[model samples]
Target: FDEDYLDPDSDINKMGRALALGGELDDFTASLKDTFTTPGSQWQYVSIDTHVIGMVVRGATGRSVTDLLSEKIITPMGLEHAPYYVTDGAGVAFVLGGLNLTTRDYARMGQMFLQNGRYNGQQIVPADWIAASTAPSAPTAEGQIGYGYQWWIPQGATEGEFMARGVYGQYIYINRADGVVIATNAADRKFREAGVSDQNIAIFRQISAALGGT
Candidate 1:
């Protein structure tokens, strides 16, 4: 959380090093000062954890996540324009929050998932993967903001309801029962306020209901 990442013993120095000095799994420390408990013991919202999954994908497939995203998801979705990922000094793409895509494209992605991974008459991504990824499998406490593979399941979310959220007010809200997808981008400073996320989800629900969706 500190900008002075040069200190060797900083909280997130390993991740900073991975971004700058060509990160390797061996160089990473599992938790920051043991603040986190045993793995799978609980759910913690850490963006760096997303990078580990990206690295695993890169290592196992011998391909960059960016390239795979372009080939497998972006291209097949028939987006209006090509999307890009923000990278670190080591050219490693930030798979968690670095994706830059048009709002329309975001909605298209939501629609794809809504259709169970079929887009433009093609099964771009596997329906089973979509189902599994959007399920509430994470260890987040019940009645709270649930989580799936990398998606957010807001409180009071009905079945097949999930979202991809950003630090700001950015969101790609999807509700399959309603056949709705709402993509939004915002920079509201009060995004972290209590009830903000719930309010946003409520608004989306109202909109979906208005659009003849569930």
Candidate 2:
């Protein structure tokens, strides 16, 4: 990985176009420093670490993460449409936040997690990986919520309650015990407001409780 190559400032099309241009992992790591503090030290809620995971997959197998995901996860489920990775100017798959799928497709992903990585009688993602990914890795300043690997756990959530949240109020709340997956896509007037997030969480919990999950 060429640190210089990954530096967002080094290129005009850092996240936009440079990412598609595959390069050494070091370059990606170097670019990542600007994205967050050391893992577990601080919570930034940024997309760089997810991208790093993609890089890790690529480095370990010498294959694009998109291909691996398709072979291992997507194809097995026979999803009507395959998810595609967005590329940066460099042509690297935008692992951070480039995934695009319909609400039903997103619900399928949540359902897979709800099943602990098993989908349609086949084990797609490892159960252990799912557990580790949903487990809290760090606490934000609010101390109410915690972040796991690319997933979010609400404060005081029961062991089985978790969520996959995205920007612009996109969310997938899963209650394993209740067998419910609440998927929502919204355009909140206020972005990143704690109150808004808290309200949404409250509503989700209400639904879960009404369904006898809580």
Candidate 3:
């Protein structure tokens, strides 16, 4: 069966809910097996492969995502509030969208990116990783939004203009030219509407301009 796991109506979504509720890794793998095997062209736009990322990180470092993140990023950044993730019953951190962080913490991350991965005189994320991840590397159509490694490069954006976007209008916008970072959290049910993403970017640009990032 050609299972569109990205589809809300698909069986994978049901399995995803179970995964969210502390299901096992084997269950998630089974869900994938029940679906299509090969990735389609749309794979460029969406991929639910974060489980593999968690596995790789653990295998490579022999540490959990929460531990690595806390020791490497959170603690070094000196965040006012510690971030957390929804985990499986096995305590495997959800590598995709399970992270819960305060808006201030989000901005701190954006600022770190803006400063080439340095925060409070400490190197959080590697500078090369920041540059490579934020670069326009995705095969997107011209004048459309572009995807970098887990980051978004808006249409018409120059170098150093990128965002970390999340569900329900959550955003950490960085404008390096004018030294601006904007963090926002929202409960937007209409986020999938046409032009919503563009409008959000426009609003962020307006905010950036207002903050002397022009």
Candidate 4:
């Protein structure tokens, strides 16, 4: 299913609510079976997965994902001015890619991950979550890229390098070994073209090298 086709009032969306409410395997498995037979067999970048993950977070905690993220991630990082998701046409927080934040705030998040989920002497996100979320778990052929949980691992990054990227040229490139992070936001005319990726990667590499990476 096209991630963009997600309807806030659709059955899947309802399933997401159920999953968020601790509905158990009967809820999650039912949803998955309706979607696919086996996990990781087919590789598709569906935004609904992250939305469902948000649901899971909401269900696990008694708070909304937005609030939880703010309490745990944003506030601690001092991103009081971060641009969160406005209501979609359907009045739901578009969890797929609806978050907006300043370049410096995004860089702070990248730096947090580069520091292994520790920020300001506090462990915000679990280190295991950071590791697993940034590690490539599926194949991305046909000029596409590898996928982690909701992150992207470019082809030739070092063992501990990955990125948090979004559509229309939103990026936070994190290089842990070199202690470098490049945060960028752009309004490009041709967003999905190879030129954008190549240019961004080139810039990231140049910046990393300039930082004196071995």
Which candidate number maximizes TM-score? 3
Candidate 4: stretches off by over 4 Å: 3-40, 80-82, 89-91, 142-144
Give the Cα error of residue 11 in candidate 2, in Å. Answer: 13
Stretches of candidate 1 off by over 4 Å are 1-35
Predictions ranked by lDDT, top down? 3, 1, 2, 4
Better of 2 and 3 by lDDT: 3
* lDDT (tens digit, per residue) of candidate 3 on 1-214: 2235447876547656777777876457545653333554443443346556677888899988899989998899999987878777777777766788898888898999999999999788899999999998877777788888889999999669999887667899999987999999889877767899999999989988889647
Each model's lDDT? 0.80, 0.74, 0.80, 0.73
Note the residue pairs that clash in candidate 4: 20-59
| C-alpha lDDT of residue 141 in model 3 | 78
lDDT of 2 by residue, 64-108 (tens): 777877888888887767776666545566676668877888889
Each candidate structure's TM-score, on Cα atoms with residue i matched to residue i, is: 0.85, 0.79, 0.87, 0.76
Q: Which residue pairs collide in model 3, if any?
A: none
